[model samples]
Target: MTYIVAYIASLIVFGALDAIWLTTMTSRIYRPVLGDILLSDLRIAPALAFYLLYPVGLVVFAAMPALRSGSAGTALAHGALFGLIAYATYDLTNYATLRSWTLQITLIDLAYGTAVAGLTALAAYQAARWVAG
Candidate 1:
């Protein structure tokens, strides 16, 4: 039950936050920089796969461990590191291979990803605590 709560909370918080960021930034950030490479429409399957899978990673790697340790700081720290590494893996790869990818985009994504993941982990930790009690 506690782990379930943590997983759901992580999913909801991260999903909601990232949805807002993607919708808001698609025009202002992504399109401006990646317009040439941008598809006319988003591919739903890949997006759904990523959205669904990422929270599981967060749950196992960050939230679950923190929940076990009973430490919110652990959740946040691990989650942030996870986010940094995950986002960097994607953004840096793009920056390296794609002609249009930029430092600004990579840096911005790193910041947002780290912040959101940490916040999601904290939220998940709190939710798990509430459920366990």
Candidate 2:
């Protein structure tokens, strides 16, 4: 029950923030750098899957620990760490395999992921505590 609430809260908050970042910020920032490699039309399926699935990782790795400890700080720290690792995995793999991938983009993405996940986890943990009470 609580876990479900936490998951939903994390998903909603993170998804919204990520959407805003993608539409308003990242598109402009990356378009110039990625240029031709940037798809004009986004593939909805993978984007949707990423939003839906990524929250599960947050719930399990960050929210759960914070809930158990009754500490939002725990969520923030763990969530940031989780984000760093997860984003690094994607970006580093791209850097390794994709000729078009850049260190600038990878660094920017890693920073964004870390902040977004940490903040989302904090919000989710707080929401769960509110719901539990």
Candidate 3:
């Protein structure tokens, strides 16, 4: 039950933040930086999949452990680490394989991912604790 709560909370928090991030960064950062490579439209399936599933990773890797430890700090730390690793992998892979990928994009994405994921996990952990209490 706590785990379920954590998952849903993370989903809501991460989704909301990521939505804002995407909308804000699309034109100001991503589009300008990756001009010609920008897609005409987002592919719904993969986008939906990412939005839906990313929180599960947050819940499992960050929130759950924090809940067990009863420490919100744990949530933030674990989440940030997870986010960094995950984002680093994605960005580094793209930079390596795709000519269009750039250091600016990779750095921006890493920062965003680290901050957002940490915030999401901390929020979810707090939500779960609040509910449980």
Candidate 4:
């Protein structure tokens, strides 16, 4: 039950951050002619990312046997991996929609991805700790 609560709480918090990050970051690169459509869709990214996390969460769960083994760093690493994956997938899908994928542009994209991962991972770690307790 605690685990469930933690996961849910983390998802909400991280989800909001994800949306904020996406809207702000993307706006700098490409202004969507769809107006509010991007914001609406951005909200969905968190849940989408979380869904991806399910498989990774299984790994996290399995590692639970190590109990005292993992740290926030571990979560961050996992989250970073998720972010990179998300970035690649997103970039590929939106390439046509984007203006240009310059080096600076790519770096910015990566920054946003990293931000999402780090923030979410931290939230998840804290929530997990609370839940585990």
Candidate 5:
């Protein structure tokens, strides 16, 4: 039950933050470089899958451990590392395989991912603590 609460909290926090970032930040950053490669219409299925699935990774890797430790710092550090690795897996792979992918985009995304994951995990950890209390 606590795990479920933490998961939901993390998902909500991550989803909200990600939506804001995508709306306000990513387009300006990505569109100039990605141009036509940036789709005019977002494919809903993959986007939905990402939102649903990525939080599961966070819950397992960062939130659970942090909850066990009762330490927000643990959550932030582990979450950041997980984010870096996960985002790198995507951005680096695209940089390597895709003709249009840019090093700039990869680097920016890696940073963004790390920050977002760390903060989201921190939020989740704190929310769980509050809920538990």
Candidate 6:
């Protein structure tokens, strides 16, 4: 329960930071800041919001383990796997949505997934150690 809550809170913080970075730094060809919610014409289902929790949780979980093991090789491999899982979860869940239709969107999602995996893994591992010690 604590892990789940931690995942949710961490994800919200990370996601918002990501949004801010994207909005401020990225091109308009991508998304203008947090414009995804605004620009999408498709209707979002209530159940779909639940999908948010898994990707974030998986990334954090996988990353923490790999990083705590203190092997860069392990971190990279596991992080990539975590990223793939997160991407799959995201893509599969949004199949009905129009955002899932484009090549650019898919690539962008892949990048984000990989980043989340790598970053969360390292951060969670260090954080856990810090808290324990």
Worst 10 residues of 1 by lDDT: 51-60
Question: Model 6 shows how many backbone clashes?
Answer: 2
Report the lDDT tens digits of candidate 2 across residue range 60-85. 99988998999889999999998999
Candidate that beats the other on lDDT, 1 or 4, i.e. the better one: 1
lDDT of 5 by residue, 1-133 (tens): 7678778887899999999989987668888887887888899999999988888888789988998998889999989998999999999999999888989889989999999999888877877778888
Backbone collision count in every prediction? 0, 0, 0, 0, 0, 2
Candidate 1 vs candidate 2: which has greater lDDT? 1
Tens-place lDDT digits, model 4, residues 35-62: 4434444466876875557434523532
Residues 33-130 of candidate 3 have per-residue lDDT tens digits of 68888788999999889878888898999998998899999999999998999899999999999888889999999999999999999998998898
lDDT per residue (tens digit) for residues 56-84 in model 1 = 87888898899899999999999999899
What are the lDDT figures for the candidates, one per model? Answer: 0.90, 0.90, 0.91, 0.57, 0.88, 0.56
lDDT string for model 6 (1-133, tens) is 4344436544654566566755665555345533555445435574346347653555455645654575545545665677777686765566446652556666676777777666655554444444544
**Candidates 2 and 3, the one with greater lDDT:** 3
Q: Compute each candidate's TM-score over C-alphas.
A: 0.96, 0.94, 0.95, 0.61, 0.94, 0.56
What is the alpha-carbon lDDT for the whole of candidate 5?
A: 0.88
TM-score of 4: 0.61
RMSD versus native structure for model 2? 1.1
